[model samples]
Target chain A: MKPQGIKVLQLMSSRINKYLIISLQIGFLFGFYLVGGYLQKTLALPVPGSVVGMLILLIGLYLKWIPIQWISQGASALLNHLPLLFVPVTVGIMQHLDFFSGKSLWLVPIVLVSTWIVMGATGLLGQFLANRKEWDR
Target chain B: MMLLQMFFWLFITLLLYVVFRRLYQLLPYPFMIPVLTCTVVLVVVLTSFDVSYDTYFSGGQWIDALLGPAIVALAFPLYKQRKLLNKFKVEIFATVVTASLLGILSGYWLAVVSGYNEMIVSTIISKNVTTPVAMEVASMTGGQPAFAVIFVMIAGIGGAVTGPWLFQLLGISNFLGIGMAFGGASHAIGTAKALEYGEREAAISSIGLSLCALCVSLLGPLLLKWIS
Candidate 1:
């Protein structure tokens, strides 16, 4: 076949696979929804469907049924946009700014400091665990 | 006015996405800066325009609704790290329990010193979890879920921006340390950032973060009630 013919074939194949990628992502989302619903109903849990679906998908991946790279692309893309997902939430926080007036200023520093300390300590602890012979090997 | 707010959100969203894509190319981890900065800018701009959060929030809730799904997807990374997790289960278990306990105590202690009332203090305990969990904990404990969500958001944005700097200042360089710091401080969003840097780090961070939140949700109220 001519180079153009080969080029066309490549384009066609890529296009077909692109849809595959999107379908898989949607499938993962749906799986999350279904499982989330079941967990919510059966367990009387607050667990959402999407979360359960994600766990299911992760299990599938860990078992080697699903490739890490396959979902990683889509997952990373969605994860990258995490802030956008919370835009409304933060704006809502701004809405409640009045609640944090002079009286609440102290809370910010306290939360900030404690958050830093706890996080810092946890981080160091993780490192310590990782370095331990029992964990490192 | 609602339409205008939606347009504003859309505009900011597009601009931020484009800017973050560029920054990600240059920096090892640039997502937090854009995310935190965008939040600050968006809130400032919206408030300046005199748009009520109700109007802005309703417009933005479309994204907020997806927050739960986004977080649940983190199990993928958690799942991916099973080997490492298995290797460190004992340590991970120990660390998680301790981390969660410490996280709750420190958070509450700080809230108390910060002069927050009982209701606010209850909300602080759940601030480490994802919105849905935090909201549930808040309602059950008699604190405002709305307030908890905001405090959580502030913690997330604050942690995402400051996490890296704090690590460097503390001379922490291991990926595990970095990931835990991000997860512990910022929860899911921070874990997402950790994943970009390294898989092991991301997994540890993700587990550490969620575990801490769950522990806090259970213990925060108990401690608060006892103290009061």
Candidate 2:
């Protein structure tokens, strides 16, 4: 066989393997999500199952039970594209337009003011304490 | 026909999301944020076409379902931060906890002032957290998930835009302060903005974002109950 043909075959095989690994890791994420849902139903927890799933994964990873490689690709893939997932949910706002009408639109300025106030407060406190800690050290 | 319609909305959403995401990358403008832009464009298109949201969501729901696993995927980042978590846990915790509680207070106060109902108040309460988590927190607390997202966007973008200048204005130059303040207040977008400061700052920003998210998720319900 030509060397070029062999190289092309190897490349194609690696690509297939990469995809298989990605899909398998994604399957793991879904499995954790399901377990989270199950725990939520049985425990009647107020916390959302997905959030629970995340905590479980965090504990699992931290304790070295779940290797990072297990979900690195899948997790990064999902997180990177996470913003895209919200497009539909955000679009869902169209149904609730009446809620945004009337004086309720005051939300715009209210958000601007609150964000400024809260952000400013947090920054000042964080800066002060962190600098103090540096001085202590 | 039902199946075709369902596929159509789903396809259109994916198409718009991908194309706009590319454009956002090329443009990198604040208004070009793919999610906001896509939402605006899709909403306008659907509204002009006289299609009800329910009908559009018949297909869009497929996309929405991905949010569940995506939330679970959130753990990956927190896990990656194990080292930073311990090293700066004190500062991150001290500031983010206060920030989280204070953030909730601020939102609740404003909602009351604005005469918002319990539903809107609860929705507003989670505004400072990341989008997916905020949605979950809002839903768990009996707020509208969709409505919660709007506030998250406003807070995230608003923080990203104003935070750097705010920091420079106040002469707060420590990486810890820059990160914690931005992350606790702004979430993902703020963390992205922190990338300009440096990688360490971005790392701190991410941890701050997650810790604030965790605080808001766990303590948010009880805080709302106590404050309300």
Best by TM-score: 1
Q: In the order shown, what is each candidate's alpha-carbon RMSD?
A: 3.5, 3.5
Q: What DockQ does every candidate get? A: 0.54, 0.56
How badly does each model clash, as a count of residue pairs? 3, 0
Cα lDDT for residue B75, candidate 1: 72
Q: On residues A42-108, what C-alpha lDDT tens digit does candidate 2 reach at each position?
A: 9976556776787798899999999999999988777677667777877877877786788767886
Per-candidate chain B TM:
0.82, 0.72
- For model 1, residues A1-137, the per-residue Cα lDDT tens digits are 69999999999999888767854764565466577768867886643355455666777776888777666655655666665676666666676777778777667766677678767787777777667754545
Model 2 misplaced stretches (Cα beyond 4 Å): A127-137, B114-123, B130-153, B156-175, B186-214, B217-228
Reference contacts recovered by each candidate, as fractions? 0.58, 0.67
Encode model 2's per-residue lDDT on B1-228: one tens digit a residue. Answer: 989989999999999989998998898765676777888899899999999988899999988887778778867766776676677778877888888988888888988987889998898888888876788889888898877877887787778777767887888888778888878888866765665566566667766776788789888888888877
By summed lDDT, which 10 consecutive residues of candidate 2 chain B come out lowest? B191-200
Residue pairs of candidate 1 with colliding backbone atoms: A32-A49, A32-A53, A36-A49
lDDT per residue (tens digit) for residues B4-55 in model 1:
8777766666586568656655674643455665676777887898867777
Position B190, candidate 1: lDDT: 76
